[model samples]
Target: MTAAVRDIWRHPIKAHGRERLAQVDLTVGAALPWDRVWAVAHEAARFDDAAPAWAHCRNFTRAAGSPSLMAIEAEVDEASGRIRLTHPDRPEISIDPADPADAARFIAWAGPITNPDRPQPARLVRAPDQAMTDTDFPSISLINLATHAAVAAEVGQELSPLRWRGNLLLEGLAPWAEMDWPGKRLQIGSAELEVVEPIVRCMATTANPVTGERDADTLGALKRGWGHQICGVYAVVTQAGTIRAGDPIEVRP
Candidate 1:
């Protein structure tokens, strides 16, 4: 098979917004650079900055809990440590997450968009070292286009890859081929990644990225058609190098 990277994406803040990228450098034993570097801690969260660690997704404002979060777009300026957030229902705002005052401003801006029934957003929390990914270990998410096509067919509608929220989108792989990739290694350009595990489908996939509406029964479709709720795979970087869209991907035994 002639698999190649079709797109690349990074989320500077977890479950908030996605940023498209043409190319990115992968480093050994780390999440994507600047990806999920910050997360919004909700009122019920118990994350401690003194000894920061990966906490459950419930501690942060996420798309699964608040579909409205998917409607937002973010632009992060790593040099300035400033993030610009734009939402359809509200005016665009720029805030420096490093500043306590600015973090408070972000919390205020996000309050209404997130679920009011749930705990309110309190502050923005920065990961002490690596980005705050869903998995316990640092990894990148990969999705096969053919697998997405199969899911869309099962749902009887066109689906957006954004709902999957994967870091790398690969084309030319057979449907569900990625399910067998765990324990295998893949080479993209000069970087090598070892597939770690399959990513289970979550309620977040049901939310439309553009409208932020819960329109699709993705989990139901996956269960009914695939007999499982997985759509993507997580891989840990084993060799460090730059990878770009359209780069040829090779699977290694």
Candidate 2:
């Protein structure tokens, strides 16, 4: 059976944090625009000029070992080209990494604090859409919240989609069921996403993006409870547009 649409999440910056929208319009032959459009990458990395790969950065990397990241919030300000990071008592940090000077300032402030051995300095790289990584869309990734909940219930614990790092979270389906929907098609808002591959689990999923901590039992839980830790599906945008929360998703069974 088709399912009800729940919350729609868009991560402006890959692997950092998510932004929620109510609804979006579908564009012609494209996925959501500017969704995961920018990525922060470590220096001295090479990408296949022809073949696209999922490129990630320390910012998007989770700190599950330190769940404190879940408590932080990031607000990206396009006008000033800065990211305002908030962590309760800590002062707000307006980060503008585009400028070499600004990037250096951010590196000096956040580097040792976040990871002392993560190289002495960090430079932010702008990864274009031409570059590809694990994300199946020019602008989208999908996860079934229902499936995640089922896995948690099966394993007897509370879980979060942070383990999967999906671009879109669709609720209202059965647990571990989205895995069976590969090769099927579903409609999100005005967008049509073709379920393609089964997401392979990784250490990134086990690490909390915020704290950079690890949870060894995380992947094991997925393997035991759901045959695999795959919680949602990936889709290449067959169509483009905006997708927001509460949109009725049409699934072709």
Candidates in order, TM-scores: namely 0.97, 0.76
Q: Per-residue alpha-carbon lDDT of model 1 for 49-168, expressed as tens digits?
A: 788877777789898889989888888887998889888887898999889998888889998899888788888897787778988888899999999999999998999988999999
lDDT values of the candidates? 0.90, 0.57
Top candidate by lDDT? 1
lDDT of 2 by residue, 81-101 (tens): 676666543556676656778
What's the lDDT for candidate 1?
0.90
> With candidate 1 superimposed using the best TM-score fit, by how many Å does residue 231's alpha carbon deviate from the native?
0.7
Give the number of the best model, judged by TM-score.
Answer: 1
What TM value does model 1 have? 0.97
RMSD of 2: 4.1
What ranges in model 2 sit over 4 Å off?
Answer: 25-31, 47-72, 78-81, 88-90, 117-121, 131-133, 136-139, 207-216
The reply for model 1, stretches above 4 Å from the true place, is none
